[model samples]
Target chain A: MKDGLVVLDKVSYGYSPERPVLARCSFQLDANERVGLVGTNGSGKTTVLKLIVGLLKPTSGHVRIFGQPCCNERDFREVRRRVGFLFQDSDDQLFCPTVAEDVAFGPLNMGKSREEVRRIVSRTLSLLGLGGFETRITYKLSGGEKRMVALAAVLAMLPEVLLLDEPTAGLDDAAAQHVVDVLAELPQAMVLATHDPRLLGGLVNRSLRLTAGRFTPESSRDWAANPAVRSARQQTA
Target chain B: MANVIENAATYDASFVPASVWRLDGVDPRTRLIAAVSFSVLVTAVDSLPTLVAALAVVVVGAGWTGALGQQRWKRLIPVNLLVLMLLGLLPLSGGATPVLSVGPIVVAREGLVQALWIGLKANAIVLGVLVLLARLEMASIGYALGRLGVPEKLTHLLLFTVRYLEVLQREYTRLWSAMKMRGFRPRVDGHTYRSFGYLVGMLLVRSVDRADRIVAAMKCRGFCGRFHPLDHAALTVRDAWFSALVLVVLAGLAALEWA
Candidate 1:
C-alpha cells in the first residue's frame, strides 16, 4: 500500500549465520525511479536484488514488492509478474536454444496465447534493434548480441519494474552504449546493480553504494573517483 | 580472449546446414519419427543382404537430403575409425571357418561377416539420423520430441543441455587459458593430474553457481516449473507424405529381409 514499487526494510541475510553478506540493509524504489546499486565484489549488491525478487528471503526483516509482502513462492509470483530481473551473466539469463524462444519464454510462462507470445517476441527483439534475429542461435551470438537478447527476453514480459545485475559487465563500448540507450527509453522503475558508474550516466537518477552489507547514499562523482571505476571507465572509453 | 570465448560458444559447428537439405523444410516431428523408425528397422535386419540394402537406402536418402557435405563427412570419421577397428578385431575371433591364417592369428569368415553386418547397420542408422534430424536445430528437435509424447521433464532436460553446453565449454576454455598463462603445462605428472582435478572442480562450482543464477532469473520471470512452447507442432500434408514415404521404404526393407 506504499508508493514504493520495491521496499526492503531492515533486511539481513547470510548463507550461514556466521558469515552475513547483508545486514539490516533498507532501501525503497519509488515508481519510475532508476536507482543504481554500486558495490565492490561480494558487497551483497546481487544479494539485495535477489531478496527484492524473492529468490532469496531476508533473515530478519521484510521485503515488499509492489506494496505486497514477498515471503513465499506464491507471493513472489505476483512480484515477478511486475518485476524482471536480468542476471549478471548473460549466459545465465539466456538459456533457450534460439533468441526468439528465449524472448518468448517469459510471456509464454505467463500463459499468453501462442500468437501473442510470437508478437511479443518479435516486438521485444525489434525494440532492442535485433530484428531478423528470431532464429539466431543463443550460444552463437556475440557477447553484446547475447546481452541484448537477454535484455530483450526480460523486456518481453512487460514488467513494471526492472532489476538488472551488471548489464554492462563484459560488454564492449558499442554494446554497453546500446544497453544504456535501450534502458534510458524504458519508463519502469529500475534497480541496476553494477560497479561501473559510467553505465549509470543519464539512466539512474540516484546511486546507492553498498559496503560491509550496508547501503549509503553516494554521488556519481564519488564513484568516478574510485580507482577501479576509473580503470573500468578508461578501458571502456 | 573474446575470440576464444566466441569460438567456444559456437554450438556444433560440424552440423549439416539446414539450407543444404530440402528435407529440412519438413516438420521436425515427421523427420524424428521417420529417423527413429528407420533406425529401428536397420537394427532389426540381421542378414547381410538386407543390411546392405538398408545402407544403400540410407546413402540415397543422405544424398537426397544433401547430407554428403564435408562437415558431415568429418563427423563420420570417428564412426569409420571404430568400424575399421571392429573389422580388424572381430575377424580375428575364433570361429568354424578360418579365412586367413597369419602365424598365430586366424581370421574367421563368419566373424568377418558379422563385423561387416554390424558396421553396415551402424552406417545406415548414422546416415539416417544425419539426414533426418541433424539438420534441424536442437530447439525444434526438443519441440518435436515433446509433440511425439516424450516426457516433459526429458524434453526440458534436452533443451537445457543444448542451451548450456556451450556456456560450460566457454567457462572451461577460460579456465584452461588462465592455467596456461600461469605456466601450467599438462604433462604426465602428479601436478598435471592434480591441476586437471582442480580445474574440473572449479568448473563444477562455476556451473552450479551459474545454474543458481539461472534459477533466480527464471523465478524472476514468473517461471512455474513448466515450460510453454511458443510453436505448436501440427501435422501438415507434407508431413503426412513424408511419413508415408518413410513407411514404404521401411516396408520394402522388411520385404528384402524376408526375401
Candidate 2:
C-alpha cells in the first residue's frame, strides 16, 4: 500500500445492496497536492470525500489516512486532526449561534486553551476577511458571509489537508473569488469537489470526473467547455 | 435566491437591543434568577390590587430595561387575546352580584373581578420574563442555565433548538415557495391536505438528514460527546448586587401579598 496523506484503496460504498454510489474508487492525495473531483449531480463526489474523512466506511475496500487504516471513530481522530472537511452546505457547517463561536468550535473541541482558541479564531476570521464578525448572529449572515465563516471554522483547525465539497456552490462571483484567493494562499493539500471549473482554474492541478459510480481521469477543460455547464455557470454568474 | 434564504434565516435579535442598558449589563445568571423568582411570586398572588401593583412594577422594569418598545409590545398581542377571552368567558359563569344582565345572560361583578385578577397575574409574570430576558442573548441564557447547575444535556438541547429554529423556518419557507412556484395553492381539498402532509414529511426527513450531517461535522472537528464553550463570563459583584436586590424585591412582594 502506497503511503499518502489520504488514500482510498478500491473503496465502494452503498446505502443498500444492488446499488452503489461509489464503486471500487481508488485515489491518492499526497501532501501539498491539489485535486479536483468533478461530476454531475448524484455522481457520488461527496461520498468520496466522506470516505476519505472516515464519515462513511467503505463496504468492500479499505481506506487509509497517513499510512493508517481509518475504520472507526478512534481512527478518524487522526484523520480529522490533520484534514478539514468543508461541508457543501454552509448551513450544515455553521450551526453555532454566533460567528465567533462557530469558528472557535473546532479549536475548542481540539482542547486548545481558551486564550489560544480566541487568538486562532480571530486570526482565521481576519484571514478570511471576516474580522469584527465575531458577535454577528450566524443565521443573519448573508450566504457569502456564511461560506466565508464556515471556511474560517474549518481553517481554524489548521489541518494539513482540506476536503472541500462545493465550497462555492451558492456563492456569488465576489464570494467565490474571495474563497479562491484564500485557498490560493493556504499551503495545505486540498481535494475540491466543485461544479465550477473556474474555481479549479488556478487551484487544482489534476481533475477527475466521477462517472457511473467510478472515478476517471479527465482534463479540466473538457468539463469547462461543455455547453450545458458553460450555460449554467453564465446563468448563475 | 441566496439573499432570500438569508433574509428568511436571519435571527430575530430584536428581543435584545443593541444599546446596552443597566439591566443589559447585569449578569445573565442574575437576570435569570430575578425573572424566575419574580414570576413565581407574581403567579402566587390572587388579589387584584397586588397583581395590579406587580404589573405596574413589570411595566416600569420593561421601560428601564428598554424592552417597552414597539417590537416587544407586538409580541404581547397573543397574550392580550388570551386575557380578553378570559375576561369575556369568566363573566358568563354567574356570581352573587350581577354587573350586566341581557337576554338570559348575566355578567357577574365577582366573576369579572376574579377574571381580572387572573389576567393581571398572567400579564405581570409574562412582563417580568420579557423585561428580565429581553436584555440577554440566547447563548447567555444557555450559559447561565449551565452555570446554575442545569444539566449539560438540557442546556445543549435548548441552545441547539434555539439556534436551529430559524434555519428550520427558512427550510420550510423555501419548500413552500417551491410548491407555490409549481402552482400549489392550498385549499380545503384532499390534494391540498396530501401536499401539506408531504411538505411536513419532507421537512422532517431533511431535518433528520441535516442533523446527521451536523453531527458528522462536529465529530470531524473532534467533538467527543462534550460541548466546550469558548467563552465563560465569571460572576461579578454586579451579579451579586442584582441578585440581592431581586431577593429583597421578592421578599417585599411576598410581604405585600400577605399584608
Candidate 3:
C-alpha cells in the first residue's frame, strides 16, 4: 500500500453504526496494475472504490491517491481530475442530454477550452465506437450504447487511473464482451470492482477478494468454478 | 417497440413546409425573447379581429418548423376542450348583447366573441412558444437560459431533470409491470389507494437515492457547482434577422389592435 498509486489503509465505512460494511479494508493499486476487487453482493466493494476517489470518506483510516492523503473535499478535487470513476449505473453518470456534452463534461470541468473539449469528446467517443454520435440524445440510446457513451465520458478526461465499479454489470453478453475489449485496450491503470470472475480473467492482472470488511489476495483464476475459495494464498504464494 | 414509436415520431415530425420563414439558424436566446414577448402581446390584446389575425400569424410562423404537426390531436385537443368548456360557461354568465335565444335562454354575442378571443390568445401563445423553442435541441434551452442570466442552479436543474426524466419513466414502467405481475389491480377501495401511495413513496425514495448517486458521479468528474454548458450558440445574422421579423410582426399586431 505504501508505494501504490492509490492506497487505502485500514479503511472502514457504513451507512449506519450498527452494521459496518467495511471494517478495516486495506487496498493498493499500482501505476500499471489492472486489479480486480472481487466480491459478492453487498461486500463493500463500491465503498473501497469510493474511498479511493474521496466520494466517501473512510470512517477510521487514511485514504491516499497519488501518494497524497485526502482528508477533505478540497484535496480530492485534484485527485478526481487525475482519476476517472465509472459508476455501476451508467444512467446516473450520463447526466447531459446529449452524448457530446456528457463526454465533454469532465475535460471542460478541468478548464479545457471548448475547442479542445470538442476534439477530446469526438476522439473519445470514436474510440468507444460511438463515432458521429455527438448529437445523439443520451436517453434515447440503447443500454449497451449508453454504457459505451458513459465510458467515453470517463475516458474523455484522459485520467491516469480508472476506478471502474462494475463496468459491465447490466450489459448483455455481447455488450459485456465489447466493454472488456474496450477496457483492455485502454492504457489507464484501472481497479475494476465486480463479482463476475469471467470479467477478471483477461482484464485484471491481479485479484483481491473483498469479504466481510477486508481484502485478501486471490490466486485461483477459476474462482467461479470453485466458489468455495479456501483462502488458498499459502498454496499459491 | 421502440422502433415502432420512433417510426411514428419520424412520420409525425414533418408538417406542411412553409420553409420561407424557417428560423433554424436563429439563436435560442432570440427565440426565447421573441416567444416571451409574443406571449405577452397575445395575452394583452383583447380586440377580437386583432386576436384572430394574431392567431393566423402564429399558425403560419410556428407551422414552418413542423413541430406543430406532431401529436396534433394529443396536444391540441386537451387545450381546445378545456377552452370549449370555458366558452360553454362564458355564454351562461349573462351579457348585454344577446345574439340568439331558445325559450328563456339567451346567448350573448359579446360573450361568444370574448370566448373566441380567449381561445385564440391561448392557442397563439402556447403554439408560438412551442414552435420557437421545441424545434431546437431540448437541452439547449437550459444553456440558452443560462446565458440569458438565469441562475446556474436552475439551469442545472432543468438539464438534469430533462436528462433523467426518461430514466425515471422507464423505472416507473418497470415498477408498474412488476405490480401488475403481482396480481395488483386498481379498485374503488382503500387497498388500491394505499398501493398507489406506496408506489409513489417508493418512487420518491428511489429518486432520492438516485439523486445522491448522480451527485457523487458529478463530483467524481470535478463538477464544482459551476454548470458550464458546452454550447457555442452565438447570436448570428440569422438571429438578428429573426429578431427583427419578430418585432415587425408584434408591432403590426399591436397597430392592428389599437386601430
Candidate 4:
C-alpha cells in the first residue's frame, strides 16, 4: 500500500443484507495511474468507484482518500472536491440549462469567482473539442455532444483523480475515440469503470477483474499488468 | 469536431429568442416588468372602452412579435370557453331587462354587460402576457425573477424545472413508445388507466433515481447549498426604451379607464 491515492480495505456493502453487492473488496488507485475496472453487469464494479468517492457508505470497511479516513460526509467533501465522478448516464449529470452553466456549476459551487468559472468552462469545453458550446441548451445537444459536455462539466472542477463510469458506452466509434484521445492526455489518476475492453486502446495501463462482490484471484499484480485480454468489464457504477 | 458543434446550431434556432419581436434585445426583466404593468392596468379597467382598447393594444403587440411555435390561439380557448359559459349562464340568472329568451330562460341586459366586461378583461390579460413575456425563454424568466427580488429558492425551482422539463419529457415519451410497441392503446377502461398509472409510477421512481445521481454528481464537484449564476449583465439602452414604451401604453390605458 505505497501511499495509494485511494484505498478500499475489506469493504462490504449491500442494498439488503440478504443480497450483497460488494464483499471484502480491496483495491487501490495510485498517483498518475489509470486502472480499468471490469466486471459483469451487477458485480459491484460501480460500487467500487462510489465507495472511493464516498458516494455510497460501505456496510463495513475502511475507505481512505488522500491518506485520510472518509467516514462521514464532511470528510468526503474534501475528497469530492479532488475527485471527479462521471456518471454512466449523461442525463443524470447534466442538470443545468446551458452547456456553460452546467460546466460552471461545480467550479462556482466550489466558490470560484464568476470570471474564473467562465474561463474554466471555456477551457474544458475546448479541451473536449466542444468550443463555442457555452450557450447551447443541454437537452437539445446530440448524444455525443451531451457526453462531451458532461465530461466538460466534470473536468471544470479540476479534480486530481477521476472515477469514470462507462465513459465510452453507447458512443459511436468516432465519438468514443474522441473521448479516449482526450482522456489519454489528462494527467489525473483515474479509475475507469468500463465494460469496453478495446474501445480505448492503449489508454488504460492495467486492468482489474471484479466478480461476485470481490476481485478475482487473477486480478493480482501479476496478470493485471498484462496488456492483452478479451472484453473487459467496467462497472456502470 | 468543429463540424459536429457547428451542426448543433441547426437545432438551436428554437431556444434562442427570435429577432422578429423587434424587442429580443430588450432585457427579460424589462419585458417582465412591462407584462406586469399591462396586466395590472387591464385588470383594473372596468369601462368597456378601456377594456376593448387594452385588448386591441395586446392583439397588435402579439402580431408584431409573432406567435410562439404553433397552437397560438389554443391558449385563449379555455378563456373563451369560460366566457361563453358566463355569457349563457350569467344573463339567465340575473340582470334588469330581458333582452331575449326561449321559454323559461330569459337573458338580462345587466348580466350581459357584466359577462362581456369579464370576458374582455380576461382576454386582454392573457394576450398581454403572450405578447410581452411569453416569447422569452423560461431560464430568462427565472433570472429576471431573481433580479426582481424574488426569493432565491423559488427562482431555483423555476430554473431547475426548466432545465429538466425537456429531459423528463423525453423520458416520458420513451416510456410511452415502449408501451405502444407492446400494443398498449389508451382505451377508456380500467386496464388502460392502470397501465397509465403504472407508467407514471415508474417515471416517478426513475426520476428519484436520476435526482439522486444528479445530486451525487453535484457533490462530487464540491457543491454545498449555494448556487451561482454565471452572468449578471446590465440592462441595456434597449431595455430602457422598451420599458418606457410599455409604461406609456399602460398610462394611456389608465387615462381611458378613468377619463
TM-score of the first chain in candidate 2 relative to the native first chain: 0.92
Quote the true-contact fraction of every model.
0.98, 0.85, 0.92, 0.96
- Please write out the lDDT profile of model 4 over residues B1-259, one tens digit for every residue: 2233223223223443466666677888888888888888877777778888888888888777775444456668878899999988888886679999889888899999888889888888988887777666677788899999999999988877766656666677788899999999889999999998898898789878888888888888788888888989798998878878888888888988786
Model 3 steric clash total: 0
Clashing pairs in 4: A38-A233, A39-A233, A46-A237, A194-A234, A195-A234
The predicted structure with the larger lDDT, 1 or 3, is 1
The models' CA-based lDDT, in order, is 0.83, 0.83, 0.81, 0.80
Q: Which stretches of candidate 3 lie over 4 Å from their true place?
A: A223-237, B1-21, B97-110
TM-scores, all candidates, are 0.91, 0.92, 0.89, 0.90
Per-model root-mean-square deviation over C-alphas: 3.8, 3.9, 5.3, 5.8
lDDT of 2 by residue, A63-155 (tens): 888898888878988789789999998888888879989998999988899999999998998888888999998977899888889889999
Q: Give me the iRMSD of candidate 4, please.
A: 1.2
Best of the two (3, 4) by lDDT: 3
Task: Judge the docking of candidate 2 as incorrect, acceptable, medium or high.
Answer: medium
Model 2 error, position A172 (Å)? 0.5
> Candidate 1 chain B: minimum summed lDDT over ten consecutive residues — where?
B2-11
Q: Write the per-residue lDDT of candidate 3 for residues A140-206, one digit (tens) a residue.
A: 8888998899889888888999989998888886787788778879999999998655557656888
Model 2, runs deviating above 4 Å: A221-237, B1-11, B15-17
